[model samples]
Target chain A: MRIWHGLLIALGLGVAGGLYITAPAPLDAGFASDHTADTEAGALVFAAAGCASCHTAPDGASEGPQVLAGGHAFASDFGTFYAPNISPDPASGIGAWDLPTFARAVTKGVSPDGAHYYPAFPYASYQNMTDADVADLFAYMQTLPASAQPNQPHDVGFPFNIRRGLGLWKVAFMPDGYVTPAPDDPVLARGRYLAEGLAHCAECHTPRNAVGALLTDQWMAGAPNPSGKGRVPNITPAALDWSESDLIEYFTSGFTPDYDSAGGEMVEVIENLSQLPEADRAALAAYVAALPPIPSP
Target chain B: MKRIFGLSLATCALAAAAFAGSHANPALEGAVKARNAQMSVIAYHTGLLGGMAKGDVPYDAATAVAAAENLASAAAMKRAVLWIEGTEQGAVAGSRAKAEIWSDAAGFEEKAVALEAASSAMITAAGTDLDALRAAMADVGGSCGACHKAYRGPKN
Candidate 1:
């Protein structure tokens, strides 16, 4: 009995040691040391990235969306995850966060205190954001009106709630690189960057496994809406019959070839896209049109 | 014949009576089919004007004018039978129409009025210039969107 107790204790220690070793690893703090924060360019990046879509308060003060107090509720199969206040409030939001800390959180899903953010934050796709874009976004975010709204705790359950285990999940699933193949066309390249890295379009357009890791093999083939109310449509060439021009116009006006208007959550998405330059919309449409055909999932 | 049809109140009532004659769960289901067909007709003309506005379908003055005229007439349609109570989203399978259409009938009528005004403005201007058609398109689209936001749920 003494020998067995010793073995069990030893096994427990090994497991504990492994967990500690694999704790959500952030990129070196020095990675963000060089990019000069440009608030003007950052504003454009913010629009394309759609930070407000996930972070805005449901019924915030009259000051409006610029006050991103971050109480947006996102419901998923795992549980409900509320968007944290990202306003510039010194204590409630990330107001005190250094550029390095902000970069790691946005790009690596590792919080300043080293806890892993649930994948609902979409770091898998965000992990591809260029260093400069992330840095600029951080600077621009700091300019938003500060809100004292404290961050809400996510309602995820036991096994899923264990943040440390997410370190392993990241290792298994976090895309260390861009998933969309690089296109030679410069316009398409810009579109690819916006769609894959900043917009995180695949987060909804691509299906995921039981554990919620994106099924990268079925990129843009459409998936169930995280809210589970309706299915997201397939946009790959195999399913989308829209011509390149049709796509450009759709992005610009939210009008389908058949004249049906965009509905549901996509209305918000179109609002963001509409604020962007027509050239940017054109580029995004071009990239999406050129994507390799994949059958609907 | 004017390709631009504005299904007036009388015409819609007549169409409703015609559909009322059939019985696949009469009244309610017939109302659903009637409204659905009405929407289809509206969408068809919108598409022709939309295609011209987008430059995908080459713009011809006559075709654009006719499409815009059809849109004006369709937008003017007042089919009360199409929205009789109990035809909302949950009441029928594949119905994207929402309860707010009835709950907030005044607001719904305001949107219908907006659509009529927008499409009426388009008929003459659609054949004027590509830019004019585009401007009219924006108005028409806005009117359509305002109603859909309240009355149309996501695709069912």
Candidate 2:
């Protein structure tokens, strides 16, 4: 019996090792030598993701919460997960991460150390980022002055804390590669990238199932969050009353079609988006305006 | 240009009607009306900002300063007064707006205070040079978000 058990363990290890070896080789790419463009692109991504809102401490407060000095807590069904610092700090942040590792985390949900990240980081949407865009983003991040604050350990409980379980989740839900714009439909392709990559609209719009998995088929249809408090509204073109130009304007300036202001999380998104180049903001509006007016469930 | 336009009111009325039609709560209607009024002010300011951004209007320091002051005043209505405290928490559609804003009164007040503080700074800075204006705008913009991070409904 003992011999058989030992053989089973060895077989399992071999299979896991085999799977790792067969996986696609992480792509090798780098930002163009033009420092200016890379930095500009980086700023855009930062705004799109609203990185500063969560990462930074509130105003007049000492140093803005360590730039990338992640310690923000997100309460969810599985457990509480504290955000980790992604600054270029060698000791705490991703300072030592190679380009591919950063790409993998942003686009593939896998960290440089081979650990799986919780969806709170929104890599699912980020999976649509193009390689060139990711390269530029990586370079931009590298340029930020490093933050030395150490990471905050997640308060997640057992089972959820097991990194191996995330492997199963990834296999089931993770998109295999970045979204490529279809040649036939530039609008859709652009929308797909903006929605799926930069905006990560579904993170808040789509409802999660019992295990906290996103109900992808529902798409932007509204769903209740773990908070069990307020429900995220249905944002498919159908539910929204704003026109494309109006939506674009709102995103750029935070004004609703009725000229009433959007508050809360949207305000931050608007703030972040306001800083983006106008072209990108327009593209996002174009794509969102084109979504099927999916009815609320 | 402070003249009332009926389009927003019409839209809000339509939206209210669509939500529950004639039988809706008068209190909720009143609240929505108040919210709409404040939002209109924000919209008006946004229009001025648009003109400034496009260089359609001259970037006169005085007018720019006035526009910025209008923005600050418009933002000042006690946020708690605008939307009835608990109305958003019980919304039917899946909304990420938390009940915490009402339950944890102190925290909610803090968010409002933060927004107010930032808005004030923006008003002070708007009449300055373009670079200064942009930086102040960024701060003002960021203040609007800082509060939203904890309180507002998620972007659909």
Candidate 3:
């Protein structure tokens, strides 16, 4: 009996040791310290990243920057995730968070307290963003009006609610690089950055496996709408039959080639894209038009 | 014999009008067709004006005026009857209207009224100048968007 007790104690220690080694860690200090935060550039990055679409209140009735009170609920198979108040309010928002903490949260999907964030935040795509862009986004977020709304807790079921389990998910999914080979053309490169990095379009456009890992093999062939019931269309060159000009027009006006305007979550996406420069929209159109056509799953 | 033929043609015209007006509480299949036809009319006029607004087609003053008038007429049509109570997503396939339309009848009517107001403004401004047309276009788009976001389903 004593020998068995000793063996169980050894087994417990080994498990604990394995967990400690695999736990998600914050980025090393002094990493990306060279890129200075520019509030002006950050503003554009903030718009491209569509931070306000999720962070803003659901009704979003308020005009200007007052809408970032963050009560939007994203319902998924995992559970409903209430976007946290990202406003600059020191008490209830990220007002007190420093740049490094923000970077870690944005890229590594880890909170300042070392808790793992659910993939619902789309940090997997954001992980591809440049350090400069991340710094700029943090700087721009600081300039927004602070809201005192309290952060809402997620409504995940047990076992899944264990944030530590996400550390293993990060190991399987999280990485800092492009999903596909980098394009040689400058316009394509910019388009790739906007689609894959700041915009995180794949978070919705790409279908996921049973365990919720993205099916990278299919890429942007589209998936069931993450927010609800309908299927998001495949934007690969073969499936999306829009001309480059048609895409730019749709981005600018939200009208499809069929004259039907975009609805649902795409309404917000179009609203954000409309705020970008005409050139940026064109770049996006050009890049999307160039994508290798993948058959829809 | 000619008089009899004329009487039959007149009867057919009256019958068609009655069929169009009686679209309220239509059978499930008929409701989808009626609503889709109504939306198609709206889209047709919207496309004409949209083509001019985006400069995709030449901005002819006469064409702009005609399109704007057609749109206003379409918006003013008493077609709300076509949105039968049971003709939403689950009850009928291929219809993107949500059940919220019936549940929130007052809200839906308010949006319809907003569309009328926007279309009225477009009719007033469409032939005046390019700038006026552009401003009115924004209002029309916004009104359509307001209704769609609340009542329509995601595109398939």
Query: Where is the poorest 10-residue window by lDDT in model 1 chain A?
Result: A58-67
lDDT of 2 by residue, A1-297 (tens): 999999999999988875774343354454233333476777777777666666653331423333676777777887777777778899888899877778888877777667777777888788777776777778777776677877888888888787767767777666554333353567566666777778787888877777667776677788775555567778877787666667666676565554445565677678778877767777777777766677887
lDDT of each candidate versus the true structure: 0.81, 0.66, 0.81
TM-score for the B chain of model 1 = 0.80
Classified by CAPRI criteria, candidate 3 counts as acceptable
Clashing pairs in 2: A57-A65, A230-B95, A231-B94, A231-B95, A232-B94, A232-B95, A260-B39, A264-B148, A264-B152
Q: Stretches of candidate 2 above 4 Å error?
A: A1-37, A57-66, A177-188, B1-156
Model 3 scores a TM of 0.81
TM-score of chain A of each: 0.92, 0.83, 0.93
Tens digit of per-residue lDDT, candidate 3, span A1-297? 999999999999989976985587868677678987899898888888999889998876635674578989989888899999999998889888888889999998888888889999989989888999999988889999888989899999977798888888777765456787888999889988898888888888888987688888888999998667779889998699988877876776677777687777777777778778878888888888988899999
lDDT of 1 by residue, A1-297 (tens): 999999999999999987876687757759767667899888888888888878889776423548888988999999999999999998999999998888889888889899988989878878888899998899899989999988899999979998988988888887777887788889999898888888888988999999999898899999999888889989999999898878876765677888887776665566577667878888889988988899997
Predicted structure with the largest lDDT when compared to the true one: 1
Question: Which candidate number has the best DockQ?
Answer: 1
DockQ of each: 0.39, 0.18, 0.27
Off by over 4 Å in 1: A1-13, A27-36, A60-65, B1-34, B59-82, B92-94, B104-150
Worst 10 residues of 2 chain B by lDDT: B1-10
